[model samples]
Every structure is written in C-alpha cells, then in structure tokens.
Target: MSETNRQWLLAKRPDGRPTEDCFEMVEREVPDPGPREVLVRTRYMSVDPYMRGRMRDAESYAEPWDVGEAMRAGVVGEVVESNSPRWEAGDVVNGNLRWADYAVADEDQLVPVDPDRAPISTALGVLGMPGRTAYFGLLDVGRPKPGDTVVVSGAAGAVGSVVGQIAKHAGCRVVGIAGADEKVHWLTGELGFDEAINYRETESVRGALAEACPDGIDVYYDNVGGPITDAAFAHLAVRARVVVCGQISLYNAEERPTGPRKLGELITKRARVEGVLVRDYVERYEEANERLAHWVADGVVQYRETVTEGLENAPDAFLGLFDGVNIGKQVVQVSDPEN
Candidate 1:
C-alpha cells in the first residue's frame, strides 16, 4: 500500500464552465480506519453534469462543494483495511466518497458491492445514481403510455440513454436528440430508438423534431435544456408529460439567459412538467436496481461508459461534460481491483 494519498480539492468556485484551475491536487498520508470504519482504495470515480451545479457556492438540491475541501463523487472501491464487523479486506464497496485513492469511511456510509454480479465499476454508473435517475425520472415523472412518442434530449448521455431505452421497453416510439452523428446512430441503430436527431448538425431543432415526431411528442425526457427544450415544448401533444432530469446545456451559464417563453404552450397542450431528484427515490432504489439488473442480464437494455484513466485526470473528465466529449457515463479509472 502507498504511504500517501492524492486528493482533488475544490480550489475555487467556478464562475462559468469549470476549469482545472478550480481544482487543486493535494497529497496526504493514507489514514488508517478507526473503529467501525473501513479504508477503501478507489477503483472508479464518476464525473457527472450534476457535479457542476454543486460547484456553485449557492445551495441547491445537494449542498454546495466548499472551497479547499476534497471534492465528493460516486466512487467504487475495494476495502483495503477494515475495523468494522460487516466489512473485510478485499470486499468491494461503493459510496459517495472523496476523490482520493483511499477513503476512510464509516461502515454505514459504504455499501457492499457484489463483484460477481456485474463489473464493480457499474456501481458508479449503470447500477448507480445515473441509472436510477433514468428509470424513475422517465417512468414515474414522464409516465409514457404504450404507443406514446417519447423524446429524450441529451439522448446519448448516461441518464438520457437509459431513459430512451426504458421508454422503448415500455412500448413507446422513442426518438433521441444528440450532439453528434455517431451518437445519433448509436441511439437509432443499437439502442433501438425509432429515430434520432443530431442537434448540432440540424438547421433547427424544432424543425427536425417536427419531421421526426410526425405525431407530436407525448413525453419529453429533458437532459439538456435551452433550444432543445424549447423545441420539445413546441411539439408537445395534448396532456404531454415532460420529465426534467437535467439541464446540462444551462449548467455553465454565468448569467441566467432567457429563451422561448413557452408557459402558454404548456397551458394550451395541458402538459405536465416535473423535475426529479434521485435522492427522493432512494427508498425504492432496490426495486429499480433489481429490475435494471434483470434487464441488463437479459440484454433488454444496454449501456456505454466513457472512461478517463487515472485519478489525476478526474477534473478533465468533468470539464468534458460541458464540452459534450463523452457519449455515455463519464468515469475516471483510479486503480485496478484485486480479484
């Protein structure tokens, strides 16, 4: 075991899109676990769009990340040392842990991960928060009925990709809006979406949506807000359900910029718009996890991961989110786990 641990601290609050300067790497001795605690060596660290919001000093759904503190992220790790009855060395675990190679956490703060079931890294991706966000946000909030047209923005991203697939499984005509042509292909070709639009290549998002969704959109699972959301709003069917899972497009906006005023569209279409926070569905996570696992095992649903190697590159992986540099879940590979 290494004598020292390297951690990324929140150096400064980001004014707009975050840069590497906002994070400072610090080295500290790898502390031993005390009573009822375990020392975990991180294997994977997830860098998500939601973390961008947490970088702001203001409070949101989750608390803001304080400057000069180790940034927290969804981490999958292996227990290297244990002082807890429930955990032993070599046990795989997952939790919201600091961005360090090793973390000393109370046993209750860590959840056991079954390496035999799936890749343990999945505990930070498809089997973790992003997957649950997709499941509950689309099913509980969007409420897409069979034969309904379900459109997902940021459709190639982790949550959006899962949202589209789940909507398809529920017998909806799924349309995906992505940034790149390859992402569009992956959605319509492999993931079984009925159609996909490349928002970057298209002349107008609203025009493309009109062409693709000839019957109008019955459900809009929004991951990227801004023009795409406005376009989706313009095509809402009667009683359409809109699921606001993320707004990555607006995450970096320094000043809140206004766009298409469309509250009247909701009134006219009788549409229901609702925002979702994954923490609110924690009580029902096991139900979603079981079902998602079954679907994954049966090949009913698929997922992709864009991984950046090394803990040192974690900040770069985060900056990539705003740049649209990843196709699915963006995670940092910190170390290899012992089998």
Candidate 2:
C-alpha cells in the first residue's frame, strides 16, 4: 500500500454556485485504524445536490461542513485493514465517508456491500440514499392511488427517476418533468413514464403540465423548487399530496428568491405538502433495501449512472449537477477496487 493518502478539503464556503477554487486537494500520511475502526480504500464516492446545502454555515437536517476539513460523501470501498472484530481486510463496505483515497471509520458506521449481488458503486446510488429518498418520499408522503396522475420534477435524476418508477408500480399515471428533451425521452421511453415534459423547452410549464394531466395532478414529487413547483402547485387535484424532496433550483441562489404565493391554492385544494429527509426513515432502511433489491433483480425497476472518471474531478462532478450534466446518479470513481 502507498504511504500517502490523497484528500479533497473545503478551501472556503461557496458564495453561490461552488467553484473548483472552493476545494483543495492535498496529500497526507495514510491513517491507521484505531480500535473499533477500519481503514477503507475508497473505490467510488457520490456527489449529490444536498452537499451544496452543507457548504453553508447554517442549520439544517445535517451539520455544515467546516472550511479546511476533508470533504465527505457517500463512499464505497474495500477494507484495507481493520482493528474491529466485525470487519476484516478485503471486506467490501459502504458508508458516509470522506472524499479521500483512504479513510478510517468506526465499525458501526460501515455497512457491508455484496459484490456478487450488485456493483459496489450502487451502494451509493440506486440501492443507497437516493433510492431510499425516492421510496419513502413518494410512497409514504405522496401516497398516490391507482390511476392517479403523479408528476416528478428533476425526473431524470437518481431520486426522481426512482420516484417515477415506484409510482408506476403502484399503478399511477406517471408524468415526469425534466430539463432536456433527451431526459424527457429517457424517462418516458425507458422508464415507462406515461408522459414527460421538457421544462426548459416548453414555453409554458403550467400549460404543458395541464395538458399532460387532463384529470389534474394528484401527486407531485418535487425535486426542483421554483417556477416548476409553482406550475405544479397550480394544477393540484383536490386533496393532492406534494412531496418536497429537494429544491435544487434554489440551492445556488445568492438569496432565496420569492415567487408566486400559492399557499392559498393548497388551502383551496385541501392539499398536503410535506418535506422529507431520508434520515427520518432510518429505522426502516433494511425493509426498503430488501424491496429495492428485489425490484432491481426482478427487472421491475431500472437505473442509470453518470460517472466521472477520477477522484481529482470530484468537485467538477458536483458542479455539473446544477448544469443537468448527469442523467441519473452522479458519482466519482476514486480507484479500481482491486488496484
């Protein structure tokens, strides 16, 4: 094993959209795992929109990342060494890990990944947090009934794509709203969405959405909040359910922008709008993972990944989320597991 470890540190807090300058890559001596800890060699790491919120020194569901500290993400790796009885060298594991070539983590913090069952990278994507977010947010919160019209914003993304698929399985008429024509095509063509709208191309999102859902939208799985959400809110069916999974549209704003006051519409429609965090359902994680794995194995659900090739490009991969550069999950390949 190499004597040095490469790490990406937060150089400064982002003002708006984060830049490469906000991160600094540095090298340090490989860390030794203490008692009850294991040293993992990172193979893949995830770059998600939620991390943007973590950059700011503000209160949220997760703690803010301090400037000058090693950046962290959902990481999958091989156990290089262990001081914990629960793990052994060569064991594959996944966890909330740092953006470094190697990291020392508590044994309790890591979960084993079965390489024979699925690609280890997926432990950070479809079968990981994104999948869980989609499952609980859409099913528990959105609560779409059979034949109901369900629309998902950010439809081509990791979580949104899964949301649309799970809605389909529940017998909903799934409609997806995405940023590009290709994403629109992929959602409807490959993912079995009943319809898809290119929010960026459509001159009137509300009109297009109205046309797609002649019966009106019963469930809206919102990932992008802004005009898209406003447009969705305007077309809600009576007693509709709105799952606020994310607001990527506002993640990079210098100041939170105000838009149409549609709360009155919610009142008129008697709709229920609820915000979701995956951590809220941590107790049921095993239940969700078992079901998601079954769906993937049975071909009842499908997924895609948009991967960046190197650890050095992790920051660029994250910045690309705002630009709609990835079709599904965006992840960074840190190193080959066997290497």
Candidate lDDT (C-alpha), each: 0.91, 0.93
Q: TM-score per candidate, in order? A: 0.98, 0.98
What is the C-alpha lDDT profile of model 1 across 184-269, one tens digit per residue?
99999889999999989999999999998988999999999888999999999999999998888888898877754888899989
Which lDDT tens digits does candidate 2 get at residues 29-88?
999999999999999999999999889999977789999989899999999999999999
In candidate 2, position 335 carries an lDDT of: 93
TM-score, cand. 1: 0.98
lDDT of 1 at 39: 97
Off by over 4 Å in 2: none
Alpha carbon RMSD to native, model 2: 0.9
Residue 64 CA error for candidate 1 (Å)?
0.7
For model 1, the local distance difference test gives 0.91
User: Could you tell me the C-alpha RMSD of candidate 1 in Å?
Assistant: 1.1
RMSD per model, one decimal:
1.1, 0.9
